[model samples]
Target chain A: MAIPKDKMLEMLHSLLLSRRFEEALTELCQVEGKIPGMMILCTGQEAVGAGVCAALRPGDVIITNHRSHAHLLAKGADPKVLMAEIYGKRTGCNKGKSGTLHLALPEIGAPCTSTVVGAGPPMAVGRAFAQQYRGEPAVTVCFVGDGATGEGSFHEALNLASLWNLPVIFVCENNCYAGAQRLEEHTRIENIADRAAAYCMPGVVVDGNDAPAIYTTALDARARAAAGQGPTLIECKTYRWRGHGESDPQHYQPKEEIAAWRARCPVARMREAVLALGLISTDDLSAMETKVDALVREAIRFAEESPYPEPREALEDVYA
Target chain B: MPQLTVGQALNQALREEMTRDDTVFIAGEGVGVSIHDNPMLPTAGLLRDFGPRRVRDTPVSEAAIAGLAVGAAEAGLKPVVEIMFNPFFTLASDMIVNHAAKLRYLSGGKSAFPLVVRIKSGAGFSAGCQHSHNLEAWTAHCPGLKVVMPATAADAKGLLKSAIRDPNPVVFFEDMMLYFAPGPVPEDEYLLPIGQADVKRPGRDVTVVTWSRMLGVAFKAAEQLAAEGIDLEIVDLRTLAPLDKETVLASVRKTGRLVVLHEATRTGGFAGEVAAVVMEEAFESLKAPLRRVTGPDIPVPASPPLERFYIPDAEQVITAVKDIM
Candidate 1:
């Protein structure tokens, strides 16, 4: 799909904003001890989240696993709420009760994200099933990592989705590794998309760093789902810019491999492409950066000022 | 009104609810098949009647079975999941504890799970340690879950119907041993609210609280004791969580003696929790300390002789009631 010049610039701006936001969070973790330890940076994987979310309407549902900051941001969740959740403050989504691993925003239809591997797939199927049963046009998008494909729930969820013809889009952010183990070391299949054939569903592979490519693929899948063609599996080929979590030193990945991926950084490449096309002026780009920086600063201030939940509140909310 | 067994009553309740509401459905393993033509016979014709969409036979993945039920319930479906054996509940604790029980509260009261989990509990028929274990106490400890253990056919039907209609997650425990136990059941549709305790056989001497298969044992013990002029008040705790402390305390105040019974192991059993409640609420009303008659703190044995020894029978209940008196 050929991207419109204006849309291309918009994608570039969004990716850069996500990149800068994550960078700021990383620095905040160092100086203020805000994020506890080493954090997973969605540096190279920004395009997949940004592209897919951009195609979704406001009421459309999105579910994701542990590696989810980019997805939440892409779905328009306030950075303040996201940051406050990470800081475990009441101002956070889920009232800081669900931390980073399990944040929820019902207003945006991002109900909650699960930390358990492959848990979101079945939930996404459930949501899609509900939409189907209610005759609602809303679609449910589930974001999972390559590691999740190994889980039995993933297979069960896919089969159920196919059987029910649920309007669900399964986006596999294949970052090449499940923690430190590479995809080749785990599954016999070269592409996770190939597994979709067994379920008789459309499966596509895309350069996850290419925003237009991901957005076009996701758009096509969404159309197919809306037309009652059942679920689609979109395997996003990307790389994680940081270790699995904040704690990993990443001795498993070679320095050259890291360097090679860094050269194709989603944000930097998109920004250069937009600049070369003259779609956005340098002043407009700098102003956008300044605005994002100010927004992040305000969010941090709001999070820092938010109250810690009362100790007695722990016993509350265990039931309705 | 008509008489029915506990199993038949439960099946009737499920059928009625599924007929009344389009959102209600059944899911689990061996639900569509009549295992031994007794345990799953209640659900035998349900699949054929309701079709595969409403009556599903899930794979032997307990976690997925439970997780799918939770997901479906959250999406506004009233799903009743059958966990063939009670001990297998441990595999689905993530859905039971973290998902179903907490979804409403976590959603800030914006969501109601309305899921029902049906499982067979207790030691009998030589179904050893794993299959026969009673874990009501474990489930009752959780805040959001409503635990129900019906001792009679009427309660089995009424309570199961209410659980399907309830807007919260409920764990419905059925005693495998009581599947053949018969009692009076109303033919017309009815509902029994969760958290109510029923006084099966009222007396003035000592109060005996029990549930599930042990209710029968308590009743037998009361009957035997009545012959000796030792009138016993038997309170069937149909629901474990949201316990009817009012009924228990009122009975305790009048009798001034208490005996709690269960087929589960003594330590950390539901009996212990009942004892704690009695001590906390009606300490001054007690003529004697609360006595608990329960299974020994060990795995249920597979042999018939050893299984008989593993569970508390009528004699044990009589002894515990007399000791309290």
Candidate 2:
């Protein structure tokens, strides 16, 4: 299925913005030491979040994992508040409580993100179950890393979603590693999507680095869910260019592998594709890059300028 | 008012809440089919009354069951889910503890996770440690959760109703042995506030703090002790978290003696918490060292005789009270 040039441009913009925001965050956390906590970045895996979220509507629910900035950006979460959260500012989406790992924007249908591996799917099932119970046509999208697939929670979630024929899409970003452990070392299965057949759901594998490919797959999954066809497992085989968390030295992964994945950057690929469509020029792409850079800088400035919550605020959110 | 079992009271609460609000639903394994075939158990006729959409019978997936409640609650629906056995709560703890309990706080108080997780607990049926363990302390320790264990039919109905309406996650524990025990339940609908203690019996000699089925043991011991002229005042803490420390301390101050009683094993039991509170707040008023009448620090054995021994009985309560006296 061919995507329109306008939608492609929008996705290209989201890709650029996500890449620029993360790059700025990395600098703040690593060089400047401004950000705190264990922040995980979606450096090279931008296409999966951008493409999949672009296929969804604003009201569609999304259950995010620890590496969640890209998906939140694609789903229209305010980057300024997200950055403020990373800075532990009171202006943050979670009022400095969630930090970077557990940010959520419920108004946009992206509830709290789970830092626990394999936890999002079961909650996604609940969100979908609520949607179905309320007779709403909205679908729920659950994002997880390849490592999450090995969790028993993930399997249980899949079984229940299928058994109930609920509207949910499980998007597994196969970045070839679960933390420092490579895919082969962690899971014996060659294709994570193949496990969907065991649960009697459609299994589709897409190119993780290819935005159009992932968008197409996610669109079909969303449609199937809308038609009451239950869930579909879409595995996007991608790679992360950075370490699992901010503190990791990444001695486990080879330099050559990182360099190779870096060469296949999703942002550059989407930019080139947009340029090839002849709807935008190199200058236009450059202008877009400059704008995205400014947006990231503004978000950082907002976060830095924001005040930390009072110590007593920690006791505030424990109950309703 | 009518005489009803705790199970019947719980059923009345569920039925009333579901009828009052369309958003309230019940989900669990065999909730709809009544697989246990115990008419006294809640959800006995719920599937037929509320239909499958509200009274869902799910697979034996505790984690998913709890997670579903978390999501549903977050989505603005009030979900009251069940874990067949309290010990099985270990499987569902991640969703209940990590997600439901923390989501509201983690959302910076921007969200309210209004849900209830109903669990059947207590040891006496020889269901072994896995099915019979009373782990209220596990949940009560968490900040965001409200833990409740009701001993009477009226409190069961009233508390469950309040829990369903509460705009936070609540862990409601029902004793398996109390399912058929008869108590007076009001016919009209009513709600009990969480985090309050009830003075079951009033006396000044000794204060015995307990809840759930352990209340029966305390009451039985009180009867035997009354004949001996060592009067016992009983305090039932309906809500464990947001503990009614004022009530507990007041009772301790009046009696000038205290005994914490529970069926859970001693080491990490909530009884220790009660004892600590007394030591900290009522130390000057205490006439004797605080005593804990709790089960041994060991897993509940499956053998009937051994299980009976594993559970703290009225004899233990009486002995602890006498020792303090």
Candidate 3:
């Protein structure tokens, strides 16, 4: 299922938006202790979020992980509120509760995010089960990292998703590091998707830098899921440019490897793909960046000006 | 206006709730297929009535089912999931505590996880260590979860209904040993408050604070105590997390003594929590140091002799009460 050029370009726009948004958020986080919590920026893996969410319908659901800003933004969450949430402001997405590690906007079918490595898969499987139970032709996407493959929660969810033939897609954003521990340090499998075979599901590996590959793969997974087929594991081989969290030395990742991955940045790669397809020129791309920058600036300003939630609110929202 | 066993009562509550709301569903192992064709199974008649979709029989994937229930609950469904026994609950703790319990709080009130996790607990069946841990303390320890353990069939029926309708995620611990115990249940549909306590037998000498199947031991001990001059007030703490301290406090204040009992190991059992609360809140009212009749701090043995000795019986409760008195 090839995505139309228009849809591909739209995914490009989303990719750019996600990249710029993270860059801006990272910049703000660096501004002399402005943010409350550590930032796990999904910088290099924008295409995985952009292309996958682009293929999804508005009614479909996604459960993201800690480095979830890009995924949530790509899924059409309000950037201003998401930023405010990280800022611990009352106007934030989760009323100043979730912060960065846990951010969810149920209104956009992007519900709660589980920071535990493999937590999102089970929840995604659950929502997919609900969708199937209700007979709603809605696909549920569970976004995890390569580290999650080492976690039992991921395999547990996969087994259930396959056993029940749930309408779910497991997207492993294989950024290769589980907090300074490389993929080799964690598991023996060369591909996280390969583990899907154990669950009796199709596993596919794609270049995380290629927006078209992600978009087309996501569409195929969604179609298969909606058609009553079981889950598919799509491992997007990507890289995180920064430290796992904000500043602890990234001594584990070799500088050469980081530089190599930087050259294949998803946003830049998507831009070149779109350009080669004659969808846009450098001038149009530059203009799009400017617009994205303005939106990010507006979100930052919205976050900065928003009031911190009242201390008493700590007691609220626990029930109901 | 019907005599119902705990299992029958629970089944009726599940049926009534499922019939009342299409959004409510039951999913668990053997929920669809009753074990040994027991018509009185807690989840009996549910599958045939609600079909496979609503009354799902899951594989032994406790974590997946728990996570699935939490996800479905967040996505606008009332899901009641059973983990055949309480020990398996530890496998699903990540979902129950890390996700379901914390989601509404973490989501900043953006979503409601109207999910109930039914864990059958108690140590009488020689089910061994793995199946015997009553981790109500584990659930009650978590801030975001509402943990309820019903001691009677009526309370089981009422509380299960309430847990299903509740807007928060609830871990309902149904006593395994008490499943066949019969009691009077109301014919009309009703829901009990989640965190309320019931004073099953009011007295003025000593307050016996207990919950779940331990209430049976407390009752038996009370019978022996009544034969003497001792008057024992039995306070059944149906809910653990959002504890009804007020009820326990009032009972303790009136009786002027307390004995907290549970089948869970004594180290970190819900018994300690209840005992501590009475000490903190009703310290002046205590005429004797509070006591606890709980399983020793040891893994429940599978052997009949060891398991029998491990569990607190009527004698233990009586002795604990005597010491408190």
Candidate 4:
């Protein structure tokens, strides 16, 4: 499906916002000791999250793995609360109880995210099953890394989803590497999509840098799911612009390979596409950037001023 | 009141809960099917009665089974998942420890995981190390989970009913040996609070605290002591977490000697926790330092004689009680 002019511009803006947010977080972690330990940056894989979330309805749910900032942003989680969470403040999403790895927002249907690899697939299936049981049209979109496909839960979830014809979309962000290990070393399959054939599902691989292509593919998968046609395995061919997490020496990939991926950056590619089509004016694009920058600044300021959680509150939510 | 076995009581509780709450369901291996020759026995007619939607026979993935239960419970379904064997709990520990035990806490009290995980435990009939291990202490160590080990048919019926209705994750440990053990069980529906302890035999000479199959061994030991005119008080710790420390302390205070017993190993058995509670709360009342009559600190052996030597029987309990007294 052809994307509308306004939506295409919005997608470009969202992708840019995600990239800039990660860049800012990286800088904050380095200079200010804001995020104490390692912070996984979704630098080059912005389009995967933006496109997948764009297809989701208000009631639809999305489950994400450890590298989850992009998913949260795409699902409309307030950057301010997210920043506060990273700051370990009381006003954060988990009241500073969970760091970036575990974030949740039940009201918006992004109930929870896990750090464990391949954990989201089965959970997403469960959420989809719940929705189906309630006769709700809400679908569950599970965002996983290329490395997560190697876990047993991933295959089990796929088989179950196919057998039950669950309304779950498994989106594999194949960023070429799982930590320091390359995807080629992990699996012999030519494409992550090829494995989906074993489960009797449609598998499609799309250029992850193209926002419109990713968005269109996700929309098709969502549509198929809503029609009770079962799940779609979507392999997003993306790359990580930065090291796996902060403080990594990044000895696996050469500088040339990193520079090559940076050249095809999703945010820049989307911007060029929109500008070439004359879909958005230069001034409009500049204004959007300023707005996003100001929003991010406000979030950082809120996080800086937010109070840390009380020590006594630690045991309060242990059980419900 | 009707005479019912522990397994029958469990079936009765599950049936009662399912009938009362439309959201309650059962999912596990051999749940909907009659795999054991006890064909269609415990969950006998549940599949036909509730249909495939409610009585689901899951794939042979304990992790998936448990993860699915957690998800279902979080989504407002009361799920009773069967692990078939106690040793299989190792496979599901990720869900039990990470998700089921931490969901409410991680969600900041926004979600409740009302999941009851039922597993058959104990080393009888030569089921060997893998099938016979008792890991209640491992579960009890977890903060958010409520662990229940009912020794009697009545307690099984009452506790299972309570577990299904509870708004927290509960690990219900059912001893395979007690499945056929019969006792008087109430016919009408009832709920037993999770943290309460039951005193099986009242005595002042020594206190014997145990639960699950070991509780029966403790009682038999109490009887042998009674024949010799040595009074023995037996306290059944029905729930592990939110333990009935008050009852245990009171019993220890009255008897002035205490012996904690269980089928699990002595190193980190539930008995150790009971001993700690006694030492912490009623240390002055002890005639001697607390004694723990537990299975040896080894895997349950395969041979009948070796398993007999490994597990703490009534004679061992009697010996421990006498030594403490």
Best-matching candidate per lDDT: 2
lDDT of 1 by residue, B277-299 (tens): 89999999999888889999999
lDDT per residue (tens digit) for residues A1-320 in model 4: 56888678668767877877888898898876677556888888999988888878888888887898888888888889888888888888888777777778776777757788888887777777777667788898999999999988888788878877889999999999999989889989869998899999999999987788999999999999988999999999999878888878799988999999988988888888888889988999899899999888998999989988898989788877
For candidate 1, the TM-score is 0.90
Docking class of 4: medium
Q: Which pairs of residues have clashing backbones in candidate 2?
A: none
DockQ of each: 0.40, 0.84, 0.82, 0.61
Native contact recovery (fnat) for each candidate is 0.26, 0.77, 0.83, 0.40
Q: Which candidate is the best by TM-score?
A: 2
Runs of candidate 2 with Cα error greater than 4 angstroms are none
- 1 versus 2: better lDDT goes to: 2
* lDDT of predicted model 3: 0.88
lDDT string, candidate 3, A112-195, tens digits: 698887899889988998898899989999999988888787888899999989999999999989898899988888988889
Better of 3 and 4 by lDDT: 3
The true-structure Cα RMSD of candidate 3 reads 1.6
How well does model 1 score by local distance difference test? Answer: 0.82
Question: How many clashes show up per model?
Answer: 2, 0, 1, 1
Per-residue lDDT tens digits for candidate 4, residues B1-325, read: 7998888888888899999998888988889985774621457678988898889888887877787787667777888989988999998888788888886777677778899999888888787889988999999999999999999999999999999999999999988778888999998777899999999888979988888998888878888889988898989999998798999999999989988888898887788788888888788988897888888888888998998898888898788777866
